[model samples]
Target: MNINSSICNLKFGLFFHLLFLSCSNRDEVKGQIPNVLFIAIDDMLPVLGCYGNSTALTPNIDTLANQGILFMNAYCQVGLSNPSRASLMTGMRPDEIKVWTLKPHFREEKPNVVTLPQFYKEKGYATRAVGKIYHDGAYHQDPVSWSNPSVLSVTRDGRGHKYVLPENYMPKRSKATTTENANVQDTAYIDGKVCQAAIELLNQLTDSTFFLAVGFRRPHLPFSAPKKYWDLYEREMFKKELKNPRRPARAPDFAFHNSNELRGYEDIGELGVIREEKQLELLHGYFASVSYIDAQIGKLIAELKRLGRYDNTIIVLYSDNGFHLGDFGLWGKTTNYEASVNIPLIFCGKGIEQGAINRSMVELIDIYPTLIDLTHGEMKSSHDGISLLPILKGKSSKVKSYALSQIVRPYQDAINSRSPDSMGYSLRTEKYRYIEWRNTKNMSVFARELYRMDDALSEKENIASDIKNEALMNQFSDIVNRIRK
Candidate 1:
């Protein structure tokens, strides 16, 4: 697990990709340049009607998916918020930025690395952001990346701004309820205000070609939303036994996160054990929060259409990372499992194909260059992601063979300033999600797991130990080894 050596090996691929990103191969727009509407949803997985989640009510996202291409196998570079967004916004992997943990912002590693938005700003696009774009911390949010002051004020510890009811807001009682179906307007929550702010910004920028990033913070924790959204699903829906409520069969313990993020809330009570009935409540809250965010998106979409920017603007909706709703007995994202890495990526409006489904493997990092390619031809830059013009143009089925995601285990509880003993790297292909847990000191693979990834429950067990799959295992191993060389 000599992680440092692996980091050095990653540079080989990084070097070539950097060259590819800096090439001038874009076609200049003939008229008004296409505006970019970047919508980022926190902790959102592909649980909408378009993604085939029967229980979740998300008409706005489903409708947006119908307007363009929906990528079925999109992934994030890391599971944690700060690291995941850092890698994506910079169009680089976590290893290249040396940001394995939340602290020491990506800029600390590469001081002058131009972010996705910053690159657009340099190109004369009015880039502005609202809500959780880059972790919302003084250290994590790079001030130089924005053309105007961004609006973001979140209680990073998952404590406040989660409840609308006065009784639930930092109550003197033990802990606040994990969910609040409050009878209040949408503006009572932070996400509602964020959506409003974005709409106002859009109104002002309708006359110009602006890159507006509207980020919504919901369905992440405390699952608080308007009661109307909560009424969308009946309580009986979550009571049915959740499929695979336990870890994968024979999967290593290191492969799962501690889930301290979910357990930290007060009403959750007992960090170790949660009752089945309570789990159902949490599930209901998650669905309702998703619906709540969907409503906000509906409003944003309507505003865009009203302003006449819908036709000429490119709306790219994606999440930093996927969440686990009792999958593998894991409640949150911080693992290499399918539920943690698989995200919903939809590209719509202006230069994007209509009503098509792309089953190719793509990463969050590819988005930076994809926008550049669609709007004004991608420019020469320091990014490490390849432009996805081929896939979007329907010329190629896929841009990459597999998606890569990695995480450092035993690094969840920060503030103590702890380091990981092992690093896990997982390669996701069309057929399988393979992982190798290696020693960070020696760079030797200590444990391995392989999932068929054919269906939802295909990851319920690991099949790498079977001799029949040894050839498949070696083939995946070679891909991982090649990156190190």
Candidate 2:
């Protein structure tokens, strides 16, 4: 434990001792501190039933939105899993964490940096994580963040199992098929078993004030889900033509990737152009996976209500990054575009204004301080994010001008930790998404893009250098330079 954690524990012990002498159970102190149920979905965008998407079959998530504050314009600091998760969990920027890739865990960069869960655990909360909370690998997972042994999918609970159908998993091919649907129970796959374990953990956490992180791995790549979820929607629904199916005009070549993440599967292999028919199949799979995750969330919430902990627990649901399903001819995340950065963020619990939708922008980094402030705990350490507590209470309409999200170009799953060729700083504002691509070596402006995303997809045009917007381009440059420093 660090010095701050030691001091908090000392104070808690003294308070508990005095309460015990007065014949008061620990519940008096613990009950006042709300339990935290942090839910993380893998690669989900804001296209949910609550987010005004009629196509998605996310009734459970929609119901939760009816009882919470929904952030219509929330985003991640980084558009990749490792960097994004590390940034949000630590309340730090990707540059501060020095974790811009899928390898060399966050601890490798900031070893003793207290994570969000560690923050709660330091203040006498039983912080436990279930499923894919951190990243996928065991090396990237942090055990010190939890107060007890975490039920991680990386070990066997959920993250390891990918496919339900034997044919989908071909050892002869060295990779599984991209999508699958089995007529088996939900527990046959990863997310179902993860939810089952989380429900079981909830039963055991009755005595302690807990920060339980239930991470659902669905709507991700190789989009696998139960057959019933696939049956909920007609596959033809996903076979629609897109308005802008290519990269934005005037955008640099380095700004876009080869959609290589999806190519690792058996079917898609280094194919430069994805067939239209295959794109529909992938979209259908993605939607099915989302509904499957929603079902699991419904079950978990039912368990919370059954245990009578629903009202006292703060439920935070968010995705680490938004996904691109054939948008701009991209099939995955790791982009600074709005489709890959703008994500769904909902806060539902006691003291939160219910059914309120906020258009103001916020970052995932703010989750750390927001939760601490809600629980009335002392925040001893410094972090890059500010608390959204006031917004949660409806005291303010806006707190940030833009939710910043960035990406390093020449993108690769295992990032080239050595300074990249270029880095794009994207500022997502109310009506526009402004990007400034800087040369990494000398930090010189190499490219720029400004997309007016009020009524259409952002990839239609890049207006940064448009002659009419000369003054606006100069202002955007100054904003990027100030934030980059």
Over 286-323, each residue of candidate 1 has an lDDT whose tens digit, in order, gives 98999999999999999999987788889999999988
- What are the RMSDs of all candidates, in order? 13.3, 7.1
For each candidate, give its TM-score against the true structure.
0.89, 0.91
lDDT of 2 by residue, 224-302 (tens): 8888999998878875523247778777777888888898887897867888778878888888999999999999999
Total backbone clashes of candidate 1, pairs 3 or more residues apart or in separate chains: 8
Considering only N, C-alpha and C atoms within 3 Å, which residue pairs clash in candidate 2?
none
Q: Top model by lDDT, which number?
A: 2
Cα distance off (Å), candidate 2, residue 334: 0.9
lDDT scores in order: 0.81, 0.84
List the candidate 2 regions with Cα displacement exceeding 4 Å. 1-25, 155-160, 171-174, 241-243, 413-418
Q: What TM-score, to 2 decimals, does candidate 1 have?
A: 0.89
